[model samples]
Target chain A: MNKIIFYNIFRFIVLVFIQVVLLKNISLYNLNMPLLYILFIFLLPFNTPNWLLFFLSFTIGLTVDIFSDTLGLNAAACTIMAFLRVFYISITVQSERLETEVTPNLSTMGFRWFFFYTLLITFLHHFFLFFLEVFDFTAIINILIRATLSTLFTVFLIFTAEFLVYRKKVR
Target chain B: MNNLWRFISKYNALFLFIIFFVTSIILFIRNNDFQRVSTLNTSNQVVGVFYSKVNNVIKYIHLDTVNKELVAENMLLRNQLKASHFNDSVVVNTVTDTINRVQYQYIAAEVINKSVNSRNNYITINRGSKHGIQKGMGVICPTGVVGIVWNVSPDFATIQSVLHQDTKITSSIEGTPYFGPLIWDGENSQIATLTDIPNQINLKKGTKISTSGLSVTFPKGIAVGTVLKAGVKGGGSFLNISVKLATNFYALQYVYVVKNIFATEQQDLENLNKTQGNE
Candidate 1:
């Protein structure tokens, strides 16, 4: 468990630095497509307590908030997504215990369940983030387009990275 | 102490995380004094180097715009020179300070940092206490007011660009002595709104918006912008005006920092008048 935690910590640092420095500049057609480093919150040990999940999620959001320079916006979005993740996992994963140190890959939950789980949570996150940044929904089409594009882009990257990270099927 | 250390170690990551995050937030909130000085110093040392490189590249691309502005200013100078009282020595007092109540004292600067895309934007200039730049001094491009100085170090100052949500200046539509606090809604940088304007005022589109003497930061009659639209909001006695700013913030490369020579004295006078009259 300590080793898993340590590895995740290392990855989090790399992801945040890259997200702020390099990937932030890769805005293609008003679409700043970043597969959030917050995916670690999604990958935390299945047995981690609920309050800890909330607190950790707040921490993650606050860190991103500090770097992004927008106060409270990203924190709110991330905390909500963190709260929703347990439900997302519960509905998709029927297995009694997530025994291995590995992440909940498609091999564990299967392709259908994994896609739904990632899609639902990623959509929830992007929706909150986009609208909060804009602050008003008068231009609904613009918000919808941003939400759709960013969510699709994030979903694509998460799936591709997950596939490469853990290739073996669930036992 | 041992028990506390053990408790901390049990949740060391969480403890550390909360500590860093709260520290940043507090630093962000209480950001105007010595903490602001340190932030400006650190950012200037780091970003100054980065911007020096960017400035080298920018200098080549901006020559045409710079030349055009200089030529226009030259023409303006010539026009002012033809005015009968263009005498050199007394001219500083009689003409430059002719604007009612407010006196203009300029601090020269070169723009080292400018960002227009962000919601809360600021421009950093290469002059500070070493060159008489001070907090609350109004900053202006050759065309019009860009922002007000919010932070200053010995060698640099960061302006709270008029584009920021925090910007509030006294502005009036030309021809009316009446004025109100003009501010940006933190949405688009190009447009700002004038609040507290009486609904009965006969203002039209294209009415030039200029600084009112109500602020010591800027002199009276300096160009602010032109009104683009006007309307009375829901059951309010004040008119809402959309003003198109005169300065092109995206292209601001150089500016003059205007200091109020009698800011403190005038502030005291204003306070005295209010306090004495109120009682």
Candidate 2:
């Protein structure tokens, strides 16, 4: 438990640093921005308490918000994502499987499951974030374009990061 | 009451979610309002220091371009010096000129962090209240107008960039009385929309748009942009003008925060007018 806490703390610091310092400057044609920091929420332990999960998500989102000067935009999106994450996990992952798997990652969850999980959550997060930032219906098409492009870009980055750390199981 | 307590305990997660979500939404609304209560923002000391430290390293990568821009601006300033031009007017023994009292003072600052891709972009600068920076001051780059100082901390300040949705600058076409508010449509960073210029006034491509000095925020006749296109929209009487912004937000580095020295006096007189008119 102590090790897990330390790992998460380290991950939080590294992810926020990379997000604000490095990834913050990179935008594909001033449209797509990869928000790989969301991976911190996704990689949390499967058995993390629902309340703890929500709190962690909110904290990370608020941290990003502070750095980006968006205030509560990311916080609102992240809370909604956390709520949906709880619902999604309850329906999909069985209690028996949770005992063996320490956390959800490419190796533990398999490619297809992990892909869909990141895709759905990321899309929803981006959709909410962009629409909320714009706060208008007239630019719905532009918002949709941005959300879709950014979602794909972020998912690609997540997959690349996951592959770098992928380890084959010696059964 | 017991049943209600039991129900609440059972759905505590939902209640927590609602609470957190509502709090965030409230925060978002408060942030969107014109006057923001600054806290937990980029202007905060910790966040500002971190960004500036990081920018100190990153700024080197653009050293070549930044140097060129500074050199170009230096040339422009050098040309305006008295030595650059022969004395065109008759040399008169001049006393201290009482006619032109300095109305504006500029403070130099460096951009530590900024985001242009977002719908409402903001810039964080190194100088803040400690350097005599304040909110509502106009910030401009060598090329053109940049933004307004929105929030100020002791050592850092955040600027509401021209690319923001709520940002509107009172501007006019060069050599014409027709003026309107310049706004960003959130589509392209390079392009902004100028509204309320009547169709009766003929506009042409490449016509320069400049600050009209109508608002107290910015000074008079600063280069804003050049007209890219102009036309009537949906049978409206006003010509919808698109302007190519002069300031390249992507390459922004240095800026000048313009402080109007007589702003308080001007505002006080305006307020007095309002009170007397009401009677």
Per-model interface RMSD values are 6.9, 1.2
lDDT per residue as tens, model 1, B176-232: 877998898655667899999988878778999988878788888889999999999
True lDDT of residue A2, candidate 2: 85
User: All predictions: root-mean-square deviation over Cα?
Assistant: 7.0, 1.9
* TM-score of every candidate: 0.65, 0.95
Q: What's the true lDDT of residue B121 in model 2?
A: 94
DockQ score of each predicted structure, in the order shown: 0.10, 0.75
Alpha-carbon local distance difference test for all models: 0.71, 0.90
Give the proportion of true interface contacts each model preserves, from 0 to 1: 0.00, 0.70
Interface RMSD value for candidate 2, one decimal? Answer: 1.2
